[model samples]
Target chain A: MAVNESLRVLRTIHYDEHHYSLFVSAGTIGPKTKPGHFAMIQAGEGFRPYLRRAFSIADVTKVAGVPALEFVVKIVGVGTAALARFAEGTPLPVLGPLGVPFPIDDLLPSDRVALVAGGIGLAPLVLLARTLAARGIAADLFYGGRNENDVLKRADFERFLGPHRCRYATDDGSLGRRGRVTELFTNALAGGVRYRRVYACGPVAMFRALAELLAEAKLEGSFAMESEMACGFGVCLGCVVPMVDGRFATICKEGPCVSPAQIDWARL
Target chain B: MTVDLSTAFGRLRLKNPIGTASGTFGYGLEFAHYLDLAALGAISVKGLSFRPCHGNPPPRICETDAGMLNAIGLQNVGVDAFLAEKLPELARLGATVIANVWGDTEDDYVAVVERIGSDRRVAAIEVNVSCPNVVKGGMIFGNNPEALAALVKRIRAATGHPLVVKLSPNVTDIVACAHAAVDAGADALSLINTLVGLAIDLERREPKIGFTTGGLSGPAIRPVALRMVWEVRKAIPKIPIFGMGGIETVEHVVEFLIAGANAVQIGTANFRDPSLASRLVGELAAWCEDHGVARVSDLVDTLRTRPRPDHEFA
Candidate 1:
């Protein structure tokens, strides 16, 4: 079930010039918020910009004794730009605890999982990482970005999962391994690294490549897909993704997190 | 003074004058978790056809200035699924259900309406002749007076349910289309469906929407929608009108009524706030009471203007 709340911004943590996180009072929806669940956050007042922006729940924690929902956002368009400019205490209307989350229940303490995040894709993965830590599972965080500047929340992951368990790959070789993050993933798989399951959140191209890699590697994986939507719930049907069965799955309803087998990468 | 918010479109009566627009309200079940389903005046469920529609490809919607463009292609569960799966729950919820029916042909439209005949649950049949996103049967039937008349007549013959023909704003002459539906037995009319518009991505040199062109809706089109509702109302004063287009507030609802709508539907704004239509029902009542307007119906066609200049409307 989803609840609509007018959560005021408690603090805005800037990861960089473009990347930031808004920790807002989560009302009743925070306590139940899961890893891959997302919310439609309204950044503007009245009719300006007209639609709420959908963001993944990075983490649900407390700030100064108030329960809060953390949203990691990158300035991409108008809605995000407005969110970037929002002052502290500015009330942001949010609707969520929506969408299917990454299935962490299937993994045991002995099962090692790989968490891959690209750019602001780290938003959902952070909560997932924290949950994995709590469960005593050994998970590796494959954080990738265009450069060191684009990489976000590295210290947060390092503090929980340890620096040795975290891997970094940058497109420009500014941080760690050079070339695309998918390339690093491909190299890792080729080098005979094994995992119980892989969870990923990134651009569509990354998922398309990962789907093929996972298919070839015969591994189970979940990809958190993002789409442009009006309503974060199932009604709008605006954020539908083509499935292998020739039917479209509403991302807002069926998943923001989906099994690699469920998507039609060719169509996407 | 108590404010009377109840309104009617001939045989069809709504507890209030604020209903959810077709395509925006999906079977009235989606928003059940967000708000009480029965709280709205009516739920005009997504446009249904003889068969389930897949709609357009991804990237079907794009945000614009105070509005958005969508080419959803009217993705729906078909009429049988709605009747079997969706409608019963809506009826059970005590919400007024107006079936918004569309098809690829005139026969397709008749099949859906006839299947829904006197369900006892459905309050009215809103014929979606104005969906600009579809290639056939939608605006094709709405753009021409004779075609719309013929289609409405066929629909009229098929079912005893009150017919509300949703008109397209893309037409050259809306009054002719309004008259065609009314003369051919349409009980009421839903004015100003989304206007067809295109948005381009300069980087890709391609259209922002997957279908090249999509219907534009939201506050940006309110002025155009208001003008159309007023024009149709002035031309066809006697027929009932369910006006809609970019309506998000009580003030906009009042504007529609004064411009001659018996009721108003909240469209794209429902995407922004799923509970909006239900909220507007209460807000409208409070607004009416505060303004000393006892009856919501009293606001209909109440616009007063100085004598029109000879060339103004022409």
Candidate 2:
């Protein structure tokens, strides 16, 4: 069996106070990875620290056509903090473009695709927004950040969806919508807004709220959610969802992104 | 070029060095999309017991610094149900299948292991000694040297299959447990099952996960796991050891090998990517071939503890 080489970490740079990103050239993954997929990254040059951390594939922009992958990471704890300090030009041992990718191509022309993101959760949405732009899908994005700077990867969100459609909600109302982004989203839905497929990635609470809102609006949607993953692959039952259809399923193999209805939303 | 990941556990030789953890991999079928059941060194299915368990309720996990924690109380489909449901399918998967058995009492443990060992489908048995010994009035067997040793001996006499004792890191001295198990006729040891941990919720003034306390695993636990593996490896150099905690990649396998683990099991890594093993299997070969290394095993213990140019170790 031909095993792919562990991905080499191309560079590590800080994006904000509690956020950073790693660019890796892993042969095992896609040159243009789809949104909703993630990778299990092992940092620290040695195995003294044994576990691999899972991160969302925030942006899939190919670097010079070689198809390097980058993660939009939040330094929630120690592993990530160590990850941020990794020197540039070092190779990261990347494991995958695991889990289900967002259905970017599934968006309809007439469908108004609304991408909802919370805090650093905007990473994947930014890439999805760009794909939506390239597909010329009429869409908009609603983002909620604690403050203005916590908002992530806006360049693509603006460039792809047009600046007018992006709305923001900060606790202090530092930017656009003066409250929760979901509040703005709820307003949009209350105002007779229509979208073909609503794509969302954010806090579990945010994802739940959106699912509830989407249901209230009688709309179809998918969610890119996070689970505490040990393996970015499917074996570990650690990251799982109690499906509505019965039986527990792995998030990595079955999906990081699943139909909103398929999720045991009540469980979340 | 594929490296032989198999190593002997007394009479049984695992096909590869990679296996699954008791709690993390569940019953092992969830990965049908990404796993080739036969390719692994062995499959350590989820922890099973005499009765079905609901597991601790949700909020059962949360993200920590580099790792995560879970208190999934050996929730399983009861041993009889597992045999009836999962075994036939696993039989077809064709690799050595090791059942990780857990129970509240010595009789319970003996019974479960005996039942599993009788089946031709099961190649071996792993005793989950890390849990509290319900019969000994609740002190965990893994934390005490004599308790662990005696348990291993009891289980060994109960089953003919290769006996493996999974160790817990919650104790102050893991080496003692490792040593005791070997002395009691254990064929191998798989270890560093999550460190004891707790996560608090500021809002409700409550704790995260269904249980107030859970096992911590993931990237964060790697350092501790490596240290424990190194400690036990240094103390008992001859005994076969299967290392785990947060193993997620080919490099992790290499790390475990270097730290004295004969093989490594990908625990938390299985949660996010299903094809990680297949990919890592491929990656390890390429890494070996690229380095002009004749065998992947050559990388074991070869890494020097050179200080990284930057970053704080403590």
Candidate 3:
């Protein structure tokens, strides 16, 4: 089968300026997507923007008797801007449940799954939080953004969380905590918050800082990375992360989600 | 419903003729994530030189109408690192690896082939003579048949790998260069690397590519590619030709074969769809079986579009 597949946009909802989440309808992969996996979304068809942008699958559910996928995309480039400005019913060229997902079974039953997110990175953590809750596993989520406006779907996160464990951080101190999300991490650890597994997802610089903070505390964690991909399936040699072994590895093929131990973070 | 993408250059069989060109596939190991290694016929890694290069910096690439312009300057990890790090990975991936070798001097070219000759996985060696993005060594050997034949003769002495000399489309007479390379003992030929072309951005009052101009590739280059393939096939009859440039679909593959290409390579298209090669394989099979074409090889030199030059196949 050709790795290239197209999806019909079930709906597109603009949450705020520069941020919108689309409900996409995919065939084979709709039911199988876990929290950490991403789908490569392209707005145009042939003679396209040519490449699709990678977005973490925010959540998946049966919508209106049809299996549907949700992509929480923050408009950044020409592709996302065009998609964001597009009408709700336009067909979206999408490919893959690309990249490795989080090891859901790896977390111990009693262990806390700490989700550290920055801004739009909250989408995957929110979905992961819900997945963990459904499995009867507890998770602590620290969702951060530039301000309250950037922190999307607060009610959705809180409502689904339902006493699961959640916190908020804004860079401008516009909402919950008066500082960065990393501050919340320091506060959580200082207050004796015990976690068996820590998963961090956000910008490369932010993740690098969090990786360092987690390392200094002698805590192990997994990080989800971002790479500009041609074919999210890895046919284009564009997306490559130099591994610890000095050989380059593709983020789309090896992982968007990888253990910090595997990355040569300095090269990133 | 089956596509026979397998192609032959002399007796060497390639499972699929959809591999990338030299300097385009980046040592062939980079696409492992997007594909199953053993699936394709072969991978032609980027052009490697004796000394390491920084490659042209950012703005090395620009989007053209149906394709793109790239002045990567053949940035490679030198010959030794390729054998030590890149080749093992290519070997593990299970493709018939073809290393595209380049050099600043004649001795440099021979050294690259010598080191690669030891690799059991290297199925063929492509001598890149047409790289326009670089200044000193690339365009020199390719435009002049004497220089190209001399280089081919030296490398032919260095190793016994299937030697394929890649021609530059920018040259006035590509057929002459093809004949020279073959006369120097080259087993096969590939043409033409990106045509030397330029696009200008009116708004910025600047050339579209950073290097002022770069190799043109993509759908836009197809007609020219096909013509050159036909011309070269006319130049050297019975010798295998690896035709490429802007090929995306199976129909495009058919066009190249009809133009006298024994095999073909997929470039630029990989940037759009990673699975395009595999899909083309499927499409080629169906087209053949449906047409009662017994062997895919029969498509080569079948176009008969132009009057054959005197001495073609003589």
Candidate 4:
């Protein structure tokens, strides 16, 4: 079930000029939110920036013993910029706990899992990492960004996975590695660092490359796909991704998280 | 005083005048958790094709100033699957279901109407002659009065169910198309479908939507829709007009009614609030009471416009 409620903005944590994390005192949303599930966040006060933008729940934390929802917002467009400018305590009407969540139930105690993210894609993966940590299942994170400022929440990932588990790559070489994260992933795989399962969310180009790499390595993984969504529920049929079976699935409902095998990577 | 919200679109009497627009509202059941389906005037399911469609590729939708654009090429589970799966559930819900039918050809349209028209669960068949997304038969028929008339006439002969011809706003004179539909034996008329629009992704240096152009819908298109509805109502006073385009609030609903729409459909607003139509039913009743109106139908074609003085103008 989804609820449209006026969630109060608790605070905004600015990671950099263009990136920030919004924490809201949403008691109703926190319990229902799961990793890979997203909220349709109303950008501003009225219908000017008309549609509610979809944002992955970056993290769910408790403040003053009350559960709160956090979203990592990047100012890429007018909607995000509007949301970024909102003052604390502003009433934000959110509709969510929507879309299919990442399946983590089948993970074994000893199985190794890899969590990969690109830029703002880290929003959903961070929550997944937190859940995995709580389950005593440690997953290494391979994070990439445009530059040093773009690669967000390094210490948070390290704190959750311990030192050396959180790796990074920046396109401009302003971060740890001087190449794409896919290169790092390739090297890791070549060096025989085997992961039982892999989870990724990123740019379409990056996902395409990863899909190929996963196929070549004969590895099992799921990808959290993003599309322009009108309704974050199944109704709209606006946010669709072509599946391998030639049927278009609504990413907002059927996914945000989908198996790589289910997607027609070549067509994408 | 009890405010009667019940309304009629041709022979079909709805419990209220509020319904969800086709393509915006999925096959009724998707919103079951958020709303009481039985409360809606009707549930106009997503546009259906003769066969299941894969629709367009990624980035099928993009937000505009007060609206959004979509090129979801009428993706559906085909007529057979809808009958096998969706209709049974809709029947159980005891909700009035309006199947919005579309096709690639005239035969395709007739086949779809024939398949669902006999089902008692489906209260009416809304022929989609105005979808701007599809390549053939959609807006092509909608743009031409002769084509629209001929298509409606054929479908009218095929289905015994009340036929609501959905018109495209992209035409030069929507009244002509409205008259064409009425003359061809349409039970009612629904307008306007989304206006053709395009949005560019500057960074990618390409269209934001997978299809270069898509149909624009929302609050942005409301004024245009109201004008069209008013014009069509004036041209064909007796026919029922199901007006819809960017209706978000009860005020908009009243505005559409005053502009001569017997019934109004909520489209994009459903994305923001799934239970909006259900809420609007009570709001409309409250509005009728506040305005000293006994029946909601009394508000239809109530727009009071100043008459032009004959001596000055001529």
lDDT of 1 by residue, B1-314 (tens): 88998897788778889988998988889988778878778778999999999888888999999899999999999999999998888888898889999998999999999899889899899999999888888999999999999999999999998889999999888999999999999999998899999999999999999899999999999999898889989998889888999998899999999999999999999999988888888999999999999999999999997886677673
- Listed in order, the DockQ scores are 0.84, 0.16, 0.14, 0.80
What is the CA-based DockQ of model 4?
0.80
Candidate 3 residue-wise lDDT at B163 = 88
Candidate 4, B46-132: lDDT as tens digits: 888888877878778888988999998888889889999998998898889999999988999999998886888899999999999
Residue-level lDDT tens digits of model 3 in A190-242: 99877787888888777887888787787878777776665566444345666
Query: Which scores greater on TM-score, model 1 or model 4?
Result: 1
The TM-score that candidate 1 achieves is 0.98
Ranking by lDDT: 1, 4, 3, 2
Best candidate, DockQ: 1
DockQ for candidate 2? 0.16
Best first by TM-score, ranked: 1, 4, 3, 2
Residues A188-234, candidate 1, lDDT per residue (tens digit)? 78888898999999988778888898999999998888999899888
Better of 2 and 4 by DockQ: 4
lDDT score of residue B298 within candidate 1: 94
In order, how many clashes per candidate?
0, 33, 8, 0
lDDT tens readout by residue for model 3, B22-87: 655666665665667677766778888987765653345555666667776777788889888887
RMSD of 3: 6.3
Model 2 — TM-score against the truth?
0.70
